[model samples]
Target: MNPSRPAPLTRVDGSPVRVLVVDDEANLSDLLRMALQNEGWDARTAANGQEALNLVREFAPDLVVLDIMMPGIDGMEVLRRLRSTGNDVPVLFLTAKDAVEDRIAGISAGGDDYLTKPFNLEEVVVRLRGMARRHVAAAAAAETRLRVGDLTLDEETYEVVRGGIPIKLTAKEFDLLRYLMQNQRRVLSRSQILDQVWSYDFGGTSSVVEIYISYLRKKIDSLGEALIHTVRGVGYTIKSAE
Candidate 1:
């Protein structure tokens, strides 16, 4: 018995980053599978559109390399169906047709990228890596929720909870709090806060900065140790009371 081949390399989230090569050409798929395996990535092949769909469902691919010229449920339709279902998994299309319209149609249909036929294997690999990196970055950024100890803020929902209790804030306050949490331990000057949260030049008195900071402290720090603090002459900072 021979030793089983090791699994592909994983993305930052620990699960393997799977790539699907969808092409009717067995030789090309075979070459890609071997090349991707050498890159420490999991790779699979599909001979047609229907099989590609089935594999996408089962494989939950991190990226897909699709052939535009496949017979039957062609690559364009495959992309349409995928997008219709709101599956935004990144796809790179391979096309022998160099028509500008075809590339435009593929992109407008939802393809993330495309490679003209006879593309260098190295270029294919580079494009795939670029696509995969983008997906990972988007996934990481989709983390709408930020937390520190008992305090939590949801960027998408504009909600805040601390110590298992919901806290309400005005829009300005929420924006200010979000900025503070984003910066964490970094002290921020009034001018800095005014520029970022207020998004304008106040021109003179920074009393607005002081007022909002006080408001945040009252609402956020009243029930617990201070999470927001004045840094004397420097500015202000947020950290756990401990």
Candidate 2:
């Protein structure tokens, strides 16, 4: 990773965020990988949920772009298992099912966000990046007195703590956490976050959002309570877990 490269606003390592794309559609996975990589993320792919889980343990991705309708070990089941293992990695569900119930079910099942099929790749990238940013911020803020839920963020020394346990975060992670806490509980659009936190015009990709959200999940949700929620057909919000 280039030291000069602008680290993800939400990662502690200041390195390119890592992502796992889980879909049975080879073509879709390839396209997503290319798009994510274009944004400087370490993007990888899996053909199914089981394969995705294997990669998750190995790659330890910051976020997962999961297809809800895979052939085996569908996205919902995969999420269930991940939660069962106490893995709070942020997940953005991609599905052909746009029914309101389906969307609700996804959120109720612990998904950080959801995207419908026939979606624009750029939008997907944007939303994902938004997620990643919030997560990174939460993780980085774990140090000092800043607290989101039971998680605490310390701006003075750049530390993080959750449930009274100390958590370490990178510089970028601290910045991201501060941003979210500064605007806690607000529904922030991807474009808005990119403009404010990224400090540059995204020019078309949204994968950065996903990457950071994944980072946050690793830090915050790893303990079980999901503070971030996706508003289908809209954007993301950081709130006290309901």
Candidate 1 matches the true fold with a TM-score of: 0.59
**Least well predicted 10-residue stretch by lDDT in candidate 1:** 1-10
lDDT of 1 by residue, 56-94 (tens): 999989999999898999998998899899999999999
C-alpha TM-scores of all predictions: 0.59, 0.58
Clashes of 1: 0
RMSD of 2: 18.3
User: What's the lDDT for residue 53 in model 2?
Assistant: 88
- Model 2 reaches what TM-score against the true structure? 0.58
The lDDT values for all models are 0.88, 0.83
The list of candidate 2 runs beyond 4 A from truth reads 1-10, 143-242
